[model samples]
Target: MAVNTSGRTTAVDRAYSALLAEIQTGALPAGAVLAEVEQSARLGISRTPLREALVRLAAEGFVVQQSPRVTVVAGIDEKDIRSLFELRRGLEELAVRAAAERGDAAVFTALAESFSAAATANPGLADPAAHAGYYALISAYDAAVGDAIRNDYLASALRTVHTHLVRVRQLAKDNPERLVVSAGEHALIAGAIAEGDAALAAHATHVHLHNALISILSSIAGSSQTSTEGTP
Candidate 1:
């Protein structure tokens, strides 16, 4: 059944979307407790709808039930990150190959040009405004891939995976250098797709994923080491 805006169901959707965004963006950090009453008050929803939203998040693994009354945000560690990338490399490689074979050359060519421009602009994403443009370009390219692949199941699965990826991306420390390299990698993928070369696009996607996983892992490791050294 579809929910309209006038019912309690809408409240559940509202609460769910708000909480999900906070968790994905790290505003609600892992292990942060979700007290039902407090959340209801904060989100301006009734307790019943907040509870429904909490249940939805728990079912999706965004939160964990710690006790009869305690619910907390879930954490992503190194092992989880490795597992995530392993699945990503598989799904995304297949997706790019499909996209390369089926995508409109004009669409991909424009995306490629946009990515090239982004690289030249060298936004580095150091400022909040710069971050928006950089991420918007990446989102546009991913949306193009989803449309090109034309697989509902794969697209749905990838959406679920990407929700987790937003959190994983936050774990990495800011590195303007990496963002430039990433833009180039994206250009290669878009270019290969524009050329209608499935094998080449798949190869480029694989290389991109391999490098991205390495970079994110390295960033996490560096952060951990620095934290450990600073602790008594």
Candidate 2:
């Protein structure tokens, strides 16, 4: 739900969004320590609300609280990434199909605008900063499609995917070409939706996600090989 005209978003909500944004954007990278006292001081909120926000984040898999002094940003391991992408692929396929079948011109326009923003943010290859902006653009695209679909279950599924998308976005940034491919895929998906080709849109989204997974896995494999080669 969109926030009201009132500028005051709740403290806990604000804190949660802020922390999640930091973690999602890699500003608070994986395995980084999180001190509630420091965060409360930085955000100008009380420990009570910060704790509440942390609890919510933890429940959502952003942070893990192994112990009081050992809470850290959760890392998306290979298995986790694969699982999240699998779920995302399924849900996004459904969302794209619905959007294609039922979404209006405005929805298509919104998706096109988001793709333009992402392309502008990542002209060729995506660096860390460029990728962060691209992720924001993709989130907007997802939100636009979710709203166009107007299904509560689809929206819920997209929410889960978005959480893991933050991490996947970071990993993909390591391979700049993937950004170009992603932008192209978004354009194709948007075009399909605009034409009301539900089947085409769903198929395009699935292919896009599968290509992304392959690229990321390839990058990871190469990194491992390099590390092994360098070992004493």
Candidate 3:
């Protein structure tokens, strides 16, 4: 229900960001109804702007329009995860390879060091503050890679995939061990890019993504089992 009163962004943009954040954080969980009038009133925005935001989310696959008036957050399952990663692996590998060929070595070297530190720190999964810092480091790494590639088209495509990825990441909230391993893998990828070794960077990216997909799927399965067992 936080409404943006700042004139910096359009009403539609503000509504979209607020709703997207809620969806990503699982506040507006999968299958949650996004009634136009209700959300518009809650967000203190007009129905027109809210509909604009919903249309944008629908295009990004974050929401589905069941009818002209009914919209809901999209559901993500194991199959959706696999499909997302399949696209991610291809795009990210290409991005890193290009970055290796064109990026500033110093930038990637610095990212490599940061990722190494994250691996060593081994932040606890239950600690929200620690996990936020860890995710910030990953975001920095992502920005570095995106800047290195210098391709708006590729970056735009990757951004779309990452939008869905934010929701998927919630499934791995309890897997601190996986985060530690992922940090190491990122360091390897950054190190390879810093050395301007295109082939190595691409290969490292592939391996990292392969391991990440496995870990994520395993985490999702474990969470599902736990929830089922706890159900009366």
Candidate 4:
């Protein structure tokens, strides 16, 4: 949307947040072209700031510049998913271990309780709004771990991985069942951290990522096969 804002950095951040949300939510799906002039006008920002926002996205692999003014969203495939998880698994496992050893017990205890409530009342997640709230809880848990780990470089790397993770989650929107089980899994991780069990926390993170990767890859494989079988 158009905003009357001052400052180049503010303008760029505005454009970046708006575009990133759309891209992650499939509003600006892969292969969609972003024209500088059109986006600049629509976002009510100068072309300079829009260009800067696009450059940030491009660096994060969200988009690619085909020409001076043409940018297209990048597409993800099975290989990309596998690679992302390899990095995620390593980073998150290390993060959880650190968080368990260093995190405030009260912070993780509260989160664990929240996750327990979600696990019990997970049927509510069948609703889109409820699912959004559930994801917010996940984000809060991620931030808490980032804070607890007390490692700047690890947290910074995780921020990049999380950007693409939002888009990756869209791939399995059809499976509310998984979200139900996921709540309990997160509860285990948080509960372990609250109890200062580094091994248990790391193991929980590993299992959660393993299951998530399998589910996503299976979903992609099923969709591909369905498309192939439907071809005339």
Candidate 5:
């Protein structure tokens, strides 16, 4: 959690991003205690900025204050997954539809081509570098869609959703098959938007989300079963 003072971002922003990355990558697992004094020292920032970062994470539901002073990373369960996807489906559908209607066709077409390439690459989930590259493509696609929408309120809401989504994503990171399938799904959505087929884009987004939720839930169940079997 070493701070980079030379960077343009504020200390609070740096601390938040560092802590958030740790939480998402499971370096700080759910229920991991975050002692203010210790964390502030570890992040190489003062308590005031650290508290600001914690407050932001708490507001996003990534961490919860257990008492006046204690905070811990929040847990994710099947219910949380389902609830997340439910909100995601609605918001993403709206975003895709708006993008289809308002976005530059060439931009989405380029994204579709990129997604197709990612699918062909078929990077194994175990390779962190390759997987990160694939995720970067997805992030680019998301940014394109977000930019096209031009709705500040909707964009803000989606940002919050994505914050928690980063953590949930780890549950299915081992499933390369899902990654391939998701690539295809994103391609379809991007293609539909490129063609200005709002209805098709929305429908494709819905289908993609449904599949994603299933994959994540299945991965969670499998992991839980494995843990249970090993416990005895």
Candidate 6:
């Protein structure tokens, strides 16, 4: 956190990464207002670079600026969740199919290991901090699979959607069981790809995304029902 590395990432990049990390881990909760000058002072950076970092964060769906007043943490609602998941489902299925065709054993092994670790660790209840590692592992596997596709259009689309998806993933950090389930799905898809079963890999990817969407919708529904019942 000290930015003490010997000139690797630039100051703005470091600031952006730190802010994004906090947002991803839910330290900066949804709709929290961010003061540019205050953040710059805390990070020991100038306002110019902080503003630049904030702009990048906005592009990544991590922050939103409402002119002349505040820049707040963007809150992801059900609609955004639905859109992101649907896009992820399609692109992930494509990645799975490509990885299957390529038959990448190493990629599959890495994914399998991550999933196994996630399952055994129970990051949600055991160590909430570990969930970041779990998501990073999952992202690495996804990138490997996507790379095998060799389709620029698909790859570009995936990169864009992935940024948005990460923001949505913050919602489930408090639910450790969901993380475990996600790891399981990643393993299944990885297995299918490693075995060179394109159809199965695609199907697995679809089912995985579908289940995530369903879980989110179910959470929203439960909240709605509870509110309705409590109404006077």
Q: Write the per-residue lDDT of candidate 4 for residues 1-232, one digit (tens) a residue.
A: 3334654458878899999998877788788999989999999989998988898899988999777767899886778888999999999999999999999999999999998888788356555557767878998999999999999999989999988877776654356667777888999999999999999999999999998888777776766422210000
lDDT of each: 0.81, 0.75, 0.83, 0.83, 0.82, 0.73
Q: Whose TM-score is greatest here?
A: 3
Model 5 residue 28 lDDT?
92
Q: Give lDDT tens digits, candidate 3, residues 1-232.
A: 3245665688888899999999877789889999988999999999999988988899999999777777999988889989999999999999999999999999999999988887786344334456677788888888888899999999989899887888787655356677778888899999999999999999988988888888778777766622210000
- Give residue 70's lDDT in candidate 3 (0 to 100): 78
Give TM-scores for every candidate, taking all chains together and pairing residue i with residue i.
0.86, 0.74, 0.88, 0.85, 0.87, 0.72
Residue lDDT tens for model 5, 52-110: 89988898889998788679999877898889889988999999999999999999999
What candidate 5 gets wrong by more than 4 Å, as runs, is: 1-7, 121-129, 225-232
Writing each residue's lDDT as its tens digit, candidate 6 over 54-108 gives 8888886789876678899887678877877877887788778887897568778
Task: Report the Cα lDDT for candidate 4.
Answer: 0.83
Error of 1 at 219 (Å): 1.6
**Residue pairs in steric clash, candidate 4?**
none
Instruction: State the local distance difference test value for candidate 3.
Output: 0.83
- Assess the local accuracy of residue 178 in candidate 6 as a C-alpha lDDT between 0 and 100: 66
| Candidate 3 similarity to native, TM-score | 0.88
Cα distance off (Å), candidate 4, residue 78: 1.8
Runs with alpha carbons beyond 4 Å of true place in candidate 1 = 1-9, 122-129, 224-232
Roughly what TM-score does model 5 have, to 2 decimal places? Answer: 0.87
Q: Which portions of model 3 show Cα errors greater than 4 Å?
A: 1-7, 122-129, 225-232
Can you tell me which runs of candidate 2 are displaced by over 4 Å?
1-5, 31-35, 41-43, 67-70, 109-137, 174-176, 221-232
